[model samples]
Target: MAATAPSQSAPLAALSSTATELDVRDMVEALGAALTDAGIDGDLRGSITLAVSEALNNVTEHGYAGRAPGEVHMVVDLLADRVLVTLSDSGHGMPGGALPPGLLPDSSGARADLPEGGFGWFLIHKLCLDLSHTRHAGRNTLRMTFPRYLAPEKS
Candidate 1:
Protein backbone atom coordinates (compact mmCIF):
# COMPACT_ATOMS: atom_id res chain seq x y z
CA MET A 1 0.00 0.00 0.00
CA ALA A 2 1.14 3.54 -0.77
CA ALA A 3 2.20 5.70 2.17
CA THR A 4 -0.13 8.56 3.04
CA ALA A 5 2.54 10.80 4.54
CA PRO A 6 5.82 12.12 3.21
CA SER A 7 9.15 10.53 4.12
CA GLN A 8 11.60 11.75 6.79
CA SER A 9 15.38 11.93 6.96
CA ALA A 10 15.99 14.61 9.55
CA PRO A 11 18.52 14.35 12.32
CA LEU A 12 17.32 13.80 15.88
CA ALA A 13 16.48 16.74 18.16
CA ALA A 14 16.73 16.44 21.95
CA LEU A 15 15.84 18.16 25.23
CA SER A 16 16.65 17.32 28.84
CA SER A 17 14.88 18.22 32.06
CA THR A 18 14.42 17.45 35.75
CA ALA A 19 10.80 16.31 35.26
CA THR A 20 9.35 19.24 37.17
CA GLU A 21 6.18 20.92 35.96
CA LEU A 22 8.09 24.05 35.00
CA ASP A 23 10.68 22.07 33.14
CA VAL A 24 8.00 20.20 31.29
CA ARG A 25 6.46 23.48 30.23
CA ASP A 26 9.79 24.71 28.95
CA MET A 27 10.33 21.52 27.00
CA VAL A 28 6.88 21.71 25.51
CA GLU A 29 7.44 25.27 24.33
CA ALA A 30 10.81 24.41 22.93
CA LEU A 31 9.47 21.40 21.09
CA GLY A 32 6.56 23.35 19.67
CA ALA A 33 8.97 25.91 18.31
CA ALA A 34 11.10 23.13 16.94
CA LEU A 35 8.12 21.61 15.17
CA THR A 36 7.21 24.94 13.60
CA ASP A 37 10.79 25.49 12.60
CA ALA A 38 10.68 22.13 10.88
CA GLY A 39 7.60 23.27 8.91
CA ILE A 40 5.08 21.18 10.81
CA ASP A 41 1.50 21.96 9.94
CA GLY A 42 -0.79 23.56 12.54
CA ASP A 43 -3.28 20.82 13.39
CA LEU A 44 -0.60 18.23 13.94
CA ARG A 45 1.13 20.75 16.16
CA GLY A 46 -1.85 20.75 18.53
CA SER A 47 -1.91 16.96 18.74
CA ILE A 48 1.80 16.78 19.39
CA THR A 49 1.54 19.41 22.08
CA LEU A 50 -1.25 17.58 23.90
CA ALA A 51 0.44 14.24 23.68
CA VAL A 52 3.79 15.53 24.84
CA SER A 53 2.22 17.45 27.70
CA GLU A 54 0.36 14.43 28.97
CA ALA A 55 3.40 12.26 28.66
CA LEU A 56 5.57 14.68 30.57
CA ASN A 57 2.94 15.11 33.24
CA ASN A 58 2.85 11.37 33.74
CA VAL A 59 6.62 11.24 34.01
CA THR A 60 6.74 13.90 36.69
CA GLU A 61 3.67 12.84 38.62
CA HIS A 62 3.93 9.09 38.44
CA GLY A 63 7.44 8.04 37.44
CA TYR A 64 9.47 10.52 39.45
CA ALA A 65 7.10 11.52 42.19
CA GLY A 66 8.85 12.23 45.51
CA ARG A 67 12.11 10.97 44.11
CA ALA A 68 15.56 12.46 44.19
CA PRO A 69 16.61 14.76 41.39
CA GLY A 70 16.90 13.00 38.03
CA GLU A 71 16.60 13.74 34.37
CA VAL A 72 13.77 13.50 31.90
CA HIS A 73 15.11 13.42 28.38
CA MET A 74 13.18 13.89 25.16
CA VAL A 75 14.20 13.45 21.55
CA VAL A 76 12.29 14.49 18.50
CA ASP A 77 12.66 13.27 14.95
CA LEU A 78 10.82 15.18 12.29
CA LEU A 79 10.00 13.49 9.03
CA ALA A 80 8.17 14.80 6.01
CA ASP A 81 4.83 13.46 7.15
CA ARG A 82 5.37 12.37 10.75
CA VAL A 83 7.07 13.18 14.06
CA LEU A 84 8.54 10.76 16.55
CA VAL A 85 8.91 11.72 20.18
CA THR A 86 10.95 9.70 22.63
CA LEU A 87 10.87 10.64 26.31
CA SER A 88 13.04 9.00 28.94
CA ASP A 89 13.17 9.52 32.69
CA SER A 90 15.77 8.37 35.17
CA GLY A 91 13.21 7.52 37.81
CA HIS A 92 11.51 4.46 39.23
CA GLY A 93 10.20 2.21 36.51
CA MET A 94 6.79 0.69 36.42
CA PRO A 95 6.50 -2.68 38.08
CA GLY A 96 8.29 -5.16 35.82
CA GLY A 97 9.14 -2.38 33.40
CA ALA A 98 5.93 -2.52 31.46
CA LEU A 99 3.34 0.16 30.80
CA PRO A 100 -0.12 -0.73 31.97
CA PRO A 101 -2.12 -1.90 28.99
CA GLY A 102 -3.85 1.21 27.66
CA LEU A 103 -7.53 1.37 28.39
CA LEU A 104 -10.34 3.43 27.07
CA PRO A 105 -10.39 6.25 29.62
CA ASP A 106 -13.46 5.91 31.80
CA SER A 107 -14.30 9.56 31.26
CA SER A 108 -17.27 8.69 29.09
CA GLY A 109 -18.74 6.11 31.40
CA ALA A 110 -21.83 7.00 33.36
CA ARG A 111 -20.79 4.74 36.23
CA ALA A 112 -20.59 6.80 39.42
CA ASP A 113 -17.74 4.73 40.78
CA LEU A 114 -15.32 5.63 38.03
CA PRO A 115 -13.15 8.60 38.95
CA GLU A 116 -13.27 11.47 36.52
CA GLY A 117 -10.61 12.74 34.12
CA GLY A 118 -7.65 10.42 34.31
CA PHE A 119 -7.45 11.05 30.60
CA GLY A 120 -3.81 11.47 29.72
CA TRP A 121 -3.17 7.95 28.53
CA PHE A 122 -6.43 7.94 26.68
CA LEU A 123 -5.60 11.18 24.88
CA ILE A 124 -2.12 9.97 24.08
CA HIS A 125 -3.48 6.79 22.57
CA LYS A 126 -6.09 8.59 20.51
CA LEU A 127 -3.89 11.43 19.23
CA CYS A 128 -0.68 9.68 18.42
CA LEU A 129 -0.30 7.27 15.54
CA ASP A 130 1.80 4.96 17.69
CA LEU A 131 2.76 4.64 21.36
CA SER A 132 5.24 2.43 23.17
CA HIS A 133 6.89 2.35 26.58
CA THR A 134 9.77 0.52 28.19
CA ARG A 135 12.01 0.52 31.22
CA HIS A 136 15.46 -0.87 31.79
CA ALA A 137 18.21 -0.07 34.29
CA GLY A 138 15.81 2.14 36.23
CA ARG A 139 14.90 4.44 33.38
CA ASN A 140 11.46 4.63 31.82
CA THR A 141 11.01 5.53 28.17
CA LEU A 142 7.94 6.48 26.22
CA ARG A 143 7.97 6.83 22.46
CA MET A 144 5.10 8.27 20.51
CA THR A 145 4.72 8.78 16.76
CA PHE A 146 2.30 11.28 15.24
CA PRO A 147 1.22 11.73 11.65
CA ARG A 148 1.67 15.14 10.05
CA TYR A 149 -1.68 15.46 8.37
CA LEU A 150 -3.96 14.81 11.31
CA ALA A 151 -4.89 18.47 11.35
CA PRO A 152 -6.91 19.99 8.55
CA GLU A 153 -5.51 23.03 6.78
CA LYS A 154 -6.66 26.48 7.79
CA SER A 155 -9.26 27.98 5.47
Candidate 2:
Protein backbone atom coordinates (compact mmCIF):
# COMPACT_ATOMS: atom_id res chain seq x y z
CA MET A 1 0.00 0.00 0.00
CA ALA A 2 1.13 3.52 -0.82
CA ALA A 3 2.15 5.69 2.13
CA THR A 4 0.33 8.89 2.99
CA ALA A 5 0.48 11.13 6.06
CA PRO A 6 -1.74 9.62 8.73
CA SER A 7 -4.64 11.29 10.44
CA GLN A 8 -4.73 12.01 14.17
CA SER A 9 -6.06 9.28 16.41
CA ALA A 10 -8.12 9.63 19.54
CA PRO A 11 -6.09 11.07 22.39
CA LEU A 12 -4.54 7.97 23.89
CA ALA A 13 -1.10 9.08 25.03
CA ALA A 14 -0.26 5.52 24.05
CA LEU A 15 2.70 3.60 25.41
CA SER A 16 2.36 0.71 22.96
CA SER A 17 0.24 -0.77 20.18
CA THR A 18 0.23 -3.46 17.51
CA ALA A 19 2.12 -2.33 14.43
CA THR A 20 -0.62 -2.53 11.82
CA GLU A 21 -1.90 -0.10 9.21
CA LEU A 22 -5.14 0.12 11.11
CA ASP A 23 -3.37 1.17 14.30
CA VAL A 24 -0.25 3.01 13.18
CA ARG A 25 -1.86 6.40 12.55
CA ASP A 26 -3.65 6.53 15.85
CA MET A 27 -0.56 5.53 17.73
CA VAL A 28 1.57 8.19 16.03
CA GLU A 29 -0.91 10.97 16.70
CA ALA A 30 -1.54 10.00 20.26
CA LEU A 31 2.17 9.97 20.91
CA GLY A 32 2.61 13.35 19.25
CA ALA A 33 -0.12 14.88 21.33
CA ALA A 34 1.32 13.40 24.47
CA LEU A 35 4.67 15.02 23.79
CA THR A 36 3.15 18.44 23.20
CA ASP A 37 0.93 18.09 26.21
CA ALA A 38 4.01 17.37 28.28
CA GLY A 39 5.44 20.80 27.23
CA ILE A 40 7.72 19.78 24.40
CA ASP A 41 7.80 22.40 21.64
CA GLY A 42 5.94 21.93 18.35
CA ASP A 43 9.02 21.98 16.12
CA LEU A 44 10.51 19.11 18.05
CA ARG A 45 7.18 17.34 17.87
CA GLY A 46 7.11 17.74 14.10
CA SER A 47 10.61 16.37 13.70
CA ILE A 48 9.88 13.48 16.02
CA THR A 49 6.63 12.81 14.22
CA LEU A 50 8.37 12.86 10.86
CA ALA A 51 11.00 10.47 12.13
CA VAL A 52 8.49 8.23 13.88
CA SER A 53 6.21 8.26 10.85
CA GLU A 54 9.08 7.20 8.68
CA ALA A 55 10.02 4.46 11.10
CA LEU A 56 6.48 3.16 11.40
CA ASN A 57 6.00 3.49 7.65
CA ASN A 58 9.06 1.40 7.05
CA VAL A 59 7.77 -1.20 9.48
CA THR A 60 4.47 -1.26 7.67
CA GLU A 61 5.58 -1.00 4.05
CA HIS A 62 8.85 -2.86 4.25
CA GLY A 63 9.03 -5.03 7.35
CA TYR A 64 5.42 -6.15 7.21
CA ALA A 65 4.93 -5.87 3.51
CA GLY A 66 2.48 -8.21 1.67
CA ARG A 67 0.09 -7.44 4.52
CA ALA A 68 1.83 -9.99 6.69
CA PRO A 69 0.92 -9.47 10.32
CA GLY A 70 3.44 -8.71 13.06
CA GLU A 71 4.00 -6.69 16.22
CA VAL A 72 5.47 -3.16 16.03
CA HIS A 73 5.84 -1.61 19.43
CA MET A 74 6.49 2.04 20.36
CA VAL A 75 7.45 3.40 23.73
CA VAL A 76 7.94 7.10 24.53
CA ASP A 77 9.81 8.26 27.59
CA LEU A 78 10.13 11.87 28.71
CA LEU A 79 13.27 12.81 30.53
CA ALA A 80 14.23 16.06 32.20
CA ASP A 81 15.63 17.69 29.05
CA ARG A 82 14.88 15.25 26.24
CA VAL A 83 12.43 12.69 24.88
CA LEU A 84 13.15 9.10 23.90
CA VAL A 85 11.23 7.05 21.36
CA THR A 86 11.87 3.35 21.14
CA LEU A 87 10.28 1.31 18.37
CA SER A 88 10.42 -2.45 18.09
CA ASP A 89 9.14 -4.90 15.52
CA SER A 90 9.24 -8.64 15.09
CA GLY A 91 9.31 -8.34 11.31
CA HIS A 92 12.45 -8.29 9.19
CA GLY A 93 15.32 -6.34 10.71
CA MET A 94 17.05 -3.50 8.88
CA PRO A 95 19.22 -4.69 6.03
CA GLY A 96 22.57 -5.85 7.52
CA GLY A 97 21.07 -5.63 11.02
CA ALA A 98 22.24 -2.02 11.49
CA LEU A 99 21.62 1.49 10.28
CA PRO A 100 23.59 2.60 7.29
CA PRO A 101 26.34 5.13 8.00
CA GLY A 102 25.94 8.79 6.93
CA LEU A 103 23.04 7.95 4.59
CA LEU A 104 21.43 11.39 4.58
CA PRO A 105 19.70 11.99 1.23
CA ASP A 106 21.68 13.80 -1.40
CA SER A 107 19.63 16.88 -2.13
CA SER A 108 21.83 17.59 -5.14
CA GLY A 109 20.49 14.59 -7.00
CA ALA A 110 18.76 15.46 -10.28
CA ARG A 111 14.97 15.50 -10.50
CA ALA A 112 14.75 12.14 -12.18
CA ASP A 113 16.91 10.58 -9.54
CA LEU A 114 14.62 11.97 -6.87
CA PRO A 115 11.64 9.97 -8.12
CA GLU A 116 12.33 7.18 -5.68
CA GLY A 117 10.78 7.82 -2.26
CA GLY A 118 13.25 7.19 0.59
CA PHE A 119 13.50 10.56 2.32
CA GLY A 120 12.24 9.15 5.61
CA TRP A 121 15.43 7.62 6.95
CA PHE A 122 17.39 10.65 5.82
CA LEU A 123 15.11 12.93 7.78
CA ILE A 124 15.26 10.63 10.73
CA HIS A 125 19.05 10.70 10.72
CA LYS A 126 19.19 14.45 10.28
CA LEU A 127 16.54 15.35 12.79
CA CYS A 128 17.20 12.90 15.57
CA LEU A 129 20.01 13.84 17.98
CA ASP A 130 20.74 10.26 18.91
CA LEU A 131 19.75 7.08 17.04
CA SER A 132 20.46 3.49 17.93
CA HIS A 133 19.28 0.30 16.26
CA THR A 134 19.63 -3.28 17.44
CA ARG A 135 18.10 -6.58 16.41
CA HIS A 136 17.76 -9.17 19.12
CA ALA A 137 15.73 -12.34 19.40
CA GLY A 138 13.85 -11.61 16.18
CA ARG A 139 12.94 -8.13 17.34
CA ASN A 140 14.38 -5.02 15.67
CA THR A 141 14.50 -2.04 17.99
CA LEU A 142 15.24 1.63 17.26
CA ARG A 143 15.92 4.22 19.92
CA MET A 144 16.07 7.92 19.07
CA THR A 145 16.32 11.05 21.18
CA PHE A 146 15.63 14.74 20.62
CA PRO A 147 16.68 17.35 23.17
CA ARG A 148 13.82 19.37 24.57
CA TYR A 149 15.61 22.65 24.04
CA LEU A 150 16.35 22.10 20.34
CA ALA A 151 12.94 23.34 19.27
CA PRO A 152 12.10 26.95 19.94
CA GLU A 153 8.90 27.73 21.74
CA LYS A 154 5.96 28.96 19.68
CA SER A 155 5.38 32.69 19.56
After superposition on all CA atoms, what RMSD does each candidate show versus the true structure?
A: 6.0, 9.7
| Poorest lDDT segment (10 consecutive residues) of candidate 1 | 3-12
Query: What are the per-residue Cα lDDT tens digits for candidate 1 across 33-82?
Result: 88888778477888888889989988888887787657899989876667
The lDDT leader among the candidates is 1
Query: Residue-wise lDDT of candidate 2 within 6-118, one digit each (tens)?
Result: 33223224456667766888888887788878776468888888788888888887887766667787877766577778888888878787786646566687877763666
TM-score, predicted candidate 2 vs. hidden true structure: 0.79
Candidate 1 at 95: error in angstroms? 4.3
Stretches off by above 4 angstroms in model 1 are: 1-12, 107-114, 152-155
TM-score of 1: 0.79
